[model samples]
Target: MHIFYTPDITQGTYTLSEEESKHCVRVLRLGVGAVVNLVDGKGGFYTAEITSDNPKKVGLLITDVKLEFHKRNHHLHIAVAPTKNIDRIEWFLEKATELGIDEITPIITDRSERKVVKDDRLNKVITSAVKQSIKAYHPKLNEAISYHAFMNLAFEGDKLIAHCIDGDEKSYITDLVQPQQKYLILIGPEGDFTPDEVNLALNKGFKPLTLGDNRLRTETAALAVCFEINYLNR
Candidate 1:
């Protein structure tokens, strides 16, 4: 099925934006009476038939509508420091969306190599991932914020920090996470979290967990946590 994204739908018809219209009419050659699917990226999927095949503003007559519920009862939020290699972080976003993540936060830690990210570029990656995976909901991409600032925000779920530090009470992430509960996992940068940062997270009720014996890059750890959550729930 050919799917397009439009956040706004009104009355019994939907209009595709200029870019989408061009793709539908000029590129895809979808003409009037042809059937196509659309998603608002807000859990609503619409099945419509083309009314006018105008390449600039294609119009569609809505035929069917479906509302999708969250696949998993739990919400998975992963906040991690942006890696120096931007491609790796983008790859993580793609995989995490396919694995079913609710939200992602780019955090700035003391040892972080990259500080700023282009939101538009990152959002496109997310949108493409959602379409490729045929998912109705789009994971939220939060703006970059400092480690301390992120800690101050209220979290209404299980919060854990994945660090490489050796300690007596370290537990594997698979064991620490509970099923069917909202979860947030924080990952550090290449240099990892500083001593003070770890202490702050611990004091804020964030459990320190390990991914495994082998050390992982920032993006790898983030995706690993996402997979573990889905594995346990499945």
Candidate 2:
């Protein structure tokens, strides 16, 4: 069945946006009475049938609704530094959404090569991932903020920081993670977090996290954390 992202959906008939309408009526050639699935990205999933196959404004009648569809037990929020190559960060967003992330914030660290991020473009990537993965909830992408500002924000969860600093004892995520709890993790830039930055996070009550012995890139590290958290929850 074809799945469409319809975040504003409510009860009764609904209209697809012009873009989705064209894709449905023209590209997919779906006609009236065609059955399709819709996800509101807020834990609402609907089964609908096309009522008007207009190529510019296709309409549908919602037949069934499911709320809180496939809800996860925990919330995973990753604050990662944007990679110099924008594609890498975008890739991380896509994979993380599929793997189950509740929130994402692009943090700018002292060694970060990329400081600015276009939220609009990155959001589209996350939305596309949500549909592709048949997810009922959309991941929230926060505006890019400096590492210091992110640290000051109040978060009630298992706080962790992943870095490459040596001589500091770091625990594997599997050991520290507790199922059914909120988690906030910080992943630094390519050069990794400066010693001072690490110390600051530690002072803020964030624990050291180690992915493994081998070093990973900024995006890779973020995805690793996403996968690890989802795996532990599963």
Per-model C-alpha lDDT, please? Answer: 0.89, 0.94
lDDT of 2 by residue, 1-234 (tens): 688999889989999999999999889999998999999999999999999999999999999999999999999999999999999999999999999999999999999999889999999999999999999999999999999998899999899999999989999998887999999999999999999999999999999999999999989999999999988989
Task: Give me the displacement of residue 140 in model 1, in angstroms.
Answer: 0.6
Q: lDDT score, residue 63, model 1?
A: 91
Clashes of each: 0, 0
TM-score of 2: 0.98
Model 1 C-alpha lDDT versus the unseen true structure: 0.89
Off by over 4 Å in 1: none
TM-score of 1: 0.96
Q: Give the Å shift of residue 230 in candidate 1.
A: 1.3
